[model samples]
Target: MSKILIIEDDLSIGEMMTMYLYEEGYEVKRAENGTQGEQIFQTFIPDVVVLDIMLPDIDGMKLCSIFRTGSTVPILMVSAKSEVTDRVRGLQTGADDYLCKPFSMREFAARIQALLRRSQSFPTPVHETPAGHPIRLDFEKRCLYVNNKVVETTFSEFEIMRLFWQNEGRVYSREELLNKVRGFDTYVTERAIDVHIANLRKKIEADPKDPKHIKTVWGVGYKFLPDPSLS
Candidate 1:
C-alpha cells in the first residue's frame, strides 16, 4: 500500500484530507506543523506528501527545497494563494504539483492516484547505450543521475524519460505516449504529455531549449536520440 504524509497546520483540513485518503486505502500520516512534519517525513518515508504552504515553522517552499535535495518523492503543494506567481513559485521550489485551497477532494484524490500510478510504472530493462554524456538511468533503483549527481524528476517526467530511454530511436506521438505511459482512463490530455516531456528535457538535456536527447519531430511526434553525434 502507498503511504501519504499530510503536512497541514489547520487541524480540520488535515483531518478531512486524512479521512478521504484513508477511504482510498492509503497509509496516511498527519503533521500539524513543519517541525513535526519534517520529523515524520524521515521516519514514515511516504510515497507522497501533501504540503500546506502556510505552516507554523519551515514554510512549504523551504520544506520542499529540503525534501528535493534528498529525495524524488512526489510533492503536492496546497495553498490559498492561487495566483500565477504562487503556482510558479511552488513549482520552482520543487513541488511536483500544486493545488489551490478549497480544492475538490475528488480532484485531489485523482491527482494522488495518478502520481502513485506513474511512480510505480516502470518498464523492463533495455540494452545499454554507447558512452556519451554522463547521464544514467538506474532501472533497479528507479533513479536518474546526471554526471553521477542525482537528478530529481516528477513521476510523469520519470515515466516519459523511461519510455524514451527504452525506445531509443522510436518516435512516439502524444496520444501513443499517453496510452503507453499513463494508460487509458487517466484523464490526462496530450498537452500534459508535452509538459512532461518538457520537464524531462530540462532535467536530462544539456540545454532544454536545444534538447539533444528528446527531439521534437515538429509535424509528427518526439523521438529520443541516444547518439549525441548523430543529431
Candidate 2:
C-alpha cells in the first residue's frame, strides 16, 4: 500500500483530507504543524505528502526548501495564498504542485489521483493535468496527448516518462533515475532530470500554478504519481 502524510495546521482541513485519502485507499497519516509533520516524515517515510503553506509554526515554503535538500518524496502544497508568485515560489522551493484555498473536494480528489498517477508509472497509459485534461503517452510514436490532441515534447523528457511509466509506483532515487534515463553511456547528472521536469511541466500542464500531475519528492527525487485506485 502507498503511504501519504498530511501536514496542516487546520485540524478540520487535515481531518477532512485524511478522511478523503482513506476513502481513496491510501495509508494516511496527519500532523498538526510543521514540526510534527517533519517528525512523521522521518518516522513514516510516506510516498506522498499533503502540506499546507500557512502553518502556525515553520512556514511551508521554508520547510519545503529544507525537505528538498534531501528527499524526493512527492509533495502537494495547499495554501490560502493564490498569488502567482506564491505558486511559483513554492515550485522554486521544490514543491511538486500547489493548491489554492477553497477548492472543490471532487477536484481535490482528482488532483490527488493525478499526482499519484504521475508519481507511479503503470499500464494506465494516460495522465491528467489541471490545465489540460489527460496526457496520454504513446510509447510507439514517442508522442504525448492533451485530451485527443498531440503536444510536442523534448526527447529527454520523453525518455524520462518512458522509464517512469515502466517503474510505476516504485521510488527511483535521483542517482537511480539518472542512470536509467540518461543511461550509463550518457553520463547525465540528476540535475538534468530536474531541468527536464520543469520544462515538461510547462508544456503539458494547462495551469502550471496548480499542476494536476508530476510531483516532487523532496530531498529524494521526482515521481510520476498515478492514481492508486486504478492499481
Candidate 3:
C-alpha cells in the first residue's frame, strides 16, 4: 500500500482527507503542524505528501524546500491562496503539484493519484551518454553525474533533464515543458519552467551564463544538445 503523509493544521479537513485516503487503500498519517510533519516525514517516508500552506509553525513553502534537499518524494501543496504567484512559487519551491482551497475530496484524491503515478513510473535502467560525453543519467537511481561527479538536482530539474535527454535536439516551448514536467492538471505559468531550466543549467553547464547543453531557440523555446560541442 502506498503511504501518504498529510501535514494539515485544520483538524477537520485533515481527518476528512485521512478517512477518504484510507478508504482508497492508502496508509495515511496526519500532522497538525510543520514540525511534527517533518518528524513524521523522516520516519514514515511516505510515497506522497499532502501539505497545507498555513501551518502553525513552519510554513509549507519552507517545508517543501527542506524536503527537496534530501528526497524527491512527491508533494502536493494545498493553499487557500489561489493567486498565480502563489501557485508558481509553490511549484518553483519543488512541489510536484498544487491544489487551491475549497477543493473537492475527489479532486484531491485524483491529484494525489497523479503524483503517485508519476513518481512510481520514473525509474528504469541507467542511461549513459555517448562515450566521452560529460553527462550520465541513472534513471533508476534518479541521480545526475557530470564529469563523474554527482550533481544535486531538484525533482523538477531532474524531470526536465530526463525529458530533454530522451528527446535531444527537440525544442520544447515553456508551456509544453511545463505540461510535460508537472502534468496537464497543473496550471502554473510558463515562466516557472524558465526558472527550473536556469537552475538546471547551473548544475550541468560549465557556465550557466552561456549554457551549452540547453540552448534557447530564439522566437521558439529551448532544446537540449547531448553533444555540447554542437552548441
Candidate 4:
C-alpha cells in the first residue's frame, strides 16, 4: 500500500481526508503542525505528502522546502490563499501540485492519484548528455550534475531540465511545458512555467542574466540548446 502523510492543522479536514484515503486503500498518517509533520516525515517516509499552507508552527512553504532538500517525494500543497502569486510561490518552493481550499473530495483524491502515478512512472537508470556536454542527468537518482558537480534542483526543476535536455531546440510554450511537467489536470497558471524555467536557468546557466542553455523564443515560449555556441 502506498503511504500518504497529511500535515494539516484543520482537524476536521485532516480527518475527512484520512478517512477517504483509507477507503482508497492507502496507509495514511496525519500531523497537526509542522513540527509534528517533520517528525512523522522522517519515520513514515511517505510516498506522497498532502500539506496545508497555514500551520501553527512552521508554514507549509518552509516545510516543503525542508522536505525537498533531501527527498524527491511528491508534494501536494493545499492553501486557502488562491492568488496567482501564492500558487506560483508554492510551485517555485518545490511543490509538485497545489489545490485551493473548499475543494471537492473527489478532485482531491484524483490529485493524489495523479501524483502517485507520476512518482511511480519515472524511468530508471542514469541518463548522460553527449560527450563534451556540460550537463548530466541521473534519472534513477533524480539528480542533475553540471561539470561533474551536483547541482541542487527541485522536483519541478529537474523535470523541466530533463524535458529540455531530451528535446533540444524544440520550442515549448508555457502552457505546453506546464502540462508536460505538472500534468494537464493540475490547475496552475502558465506563468508558473516561466518561474520554473527561470529557476532552472539559475542552476544550469553560467549567467542567468544571459542564459545560454535555455533560451526564450520571444512571442512564444522557450527552448533548450544543447550546444549554445553552435546555435
Candidate 5:
C-alpha cells in the first residue's frame, strides 16, 4: 500500500503512469504542474515522487531540490530529455533515479519495484556486544546501536557502512561502489549512489549536513572517516 506521487504536465502520460502503478497495487497521486505538486507533497506525503523536469510552474529541478531540503523521500526523474548532462543535472539536484521518456511500461514497472525493494530493506544490525547495548556495531549480532538503541539501515547501506567501519579511513569512488553495492553497477548515472549515501548520512551520522563519518570528495567520491574515539 505504498503511496506515490506523479508530477507531470502531460495529462495522458500522467494518467498512463497512474494506471500502471495502480495496476501494480500502489496508491497513486497526480499533479499537473510543479506548484500543485509541491502542495500535494505537503498534504499527502508520498513514499516516492515520479517527477518530470519540464513543468508549468516552478520547474521539477527546483521543486526536487526544495523537497530535498527537508525530506529524504526517494525521487525518480522521468523526462523526454535523454541527454546525459540532463540526467546528471537531475541527480545533482537531489533526484535518486532517472528515466528517459518513451520507456516501456515493463521497464518502468521494474524500476519502481527495484526502488521499493531497496527502500524497504532494513538489516538486522551488527551489535558491539552481547549485552545488547546500543553503543556499538556487534559483528556477531549484525546490528548497529547508538546510545543503547538500534541503528536502522538498508541492506545495501549496511554493507557500504560495514566496509567503511572496518577500514576506518578510506575512500571509495562511485565506480568502486557500483561493484560493491551489487547490480547497481548497471545504473551508473550517480543518482543511486548519491541517494544511498544520502540515506546513510541520515541513518549513521550525528549531523548529516556536516557529516563526520561519510565525507564527500568534491570531484572524486565519498570516504569514511569515523572518529577514532567513538565506541
Candidate 6:
C-alpha cells in the first residue's frame, strides 16, 4: 500500500494512470504541472513519482533536479522523446528510470514496483570504506558522508556509489556500470560513466588526480577498494 504521485500534464493519461494504480492497490496523487507537482511531492511524500517530461509550468528535468536536491524518492521519467540524448539527459539530471512513450502498462507497473522495492528495502544499512578515515553511505537516507560530513549526490551518483560500496572489491567495466545503473534500455555512453566516476572522486576523494576508494584497473575498468592501506 505504497503512495504514488503522477505528475503529468495530459489529463487523460494522468486519470488513466491514477485509475490503474488505484486498481493495483496503491494510494495515488495527481498533479498536472511542475509547480503543483512539487507542492504535492513535499506534502504527500510519495514512495515513487511517475513524472512526465513535458509539463506546462516546469520541465521534468528541472523538477527532477530540484527533487534530488532534497529527497531520494525514486523518480521514473516518462516522455515521448525517444532520442538517446533525451534519455541520457534525463538520467544525468537524476531521474531513476526513464520510459519512452507508448510503453506497455505491464512494463510501467513492473518498473514502478521495482523502484519501490529498491527504495524501501534498506531500513538502516550503513556501508563504510575500510580505512582509518572512511566514507559512509547511509542507505536509509540515501546520503553519503566523508569524514562525517554530508556530501550531496545525484541519484545516479548515489546508485553508482551504492553499487561499489555494496561490492567493495568488485570490478565493474564502464559498460556494466552503465547497464546496471541507467538500465540497458537507456543509451548511456562510456563517457557518461567516466564523468560520473570523476565527479564522485571529486566529492569523496581528497585528491581526484589520485583516487583512493575507486581505483583504475589498468585498461580493464575500475574497482572500489575499501582499505586505503591497499592503495
Q: Of the candidates numbered 2 and 4, which has the greater TM-score value?
A: 4
Cα deviation at 49, candidate 4, in Å, is 1.2
**What lDDT does each candidate get?**
0.80, 0.70, 0.87, 0.88, 0.74, 0.83
1-231 per-residue lDDT for model 4 (tens digits): 999999999999999999999999999999999999999999999999999999999989999999988887889999999999899999889888889998998999998987787667777777888888998889888889988889888766888888887788999998888777766657785877888888888888899999998999999999999789889
How far out, in Å, is residue 167 in model 4?
1.4
Best by TM-score: 4
Off by more than 4 A, model 1 = 124-127, 169-202, 217-222
- Give me the runs in candidate 2 sitting further than 4 Å from their true place: 122-231
lDDT string for model 5 (116-155, tens) is 6655654555534335322366554555666666665534
What ranking emerges by TM-score with the best candidate at the front? 4, 3, 6, 1, 5, 2
Tell me which of candidates 4 and 6 scores higher on TM-score. Answer: 4
TM-score of 4: 0.94
User: For each candidate, what TM-score against the reference?
Assistant: 0.80, 0.56, 0.90, 0.94, 0.67, 0.83
Q: By the TM-score metric, which is better: model 1 or model 4?
A: 4
Q: Please give, for residues 109-223, the per-residue lDDT of candidate 1 as tens digits.
A: 9878877777776555643445666677877666787777778776556677788887788889898887776554433246556667777788878899998878999877899
For residues 110-195, what per-residue lDDT tens digits would candidate 3 score against the true structure? 88887777667775978998889999899999999999998877766888899998999999998888777766646555767887
Question: What tens-digit string does per-residue lDDT give for candidate 2 at 8-97?
Answer: 888788888899889988899999989999998999998888889999999998888677556656677888898876876665566656
- RMSD (CA, Å), each prediction: 3.2, 16.0, 2.0, 1.5, 6.4, 2.9
Worst 10 residues of 4 by lDDT: 180-189
Clash number for every model? 0, 27, 0, 0, 13, 0
Stretches of candidate 5 above 4 Å error? 124-176, 179-223, 228-231
Model 3, which residues run further than 4 Å from truth? none
Q: Which model is ahead, 4 or 5, in terms of TM-score?
A: 4
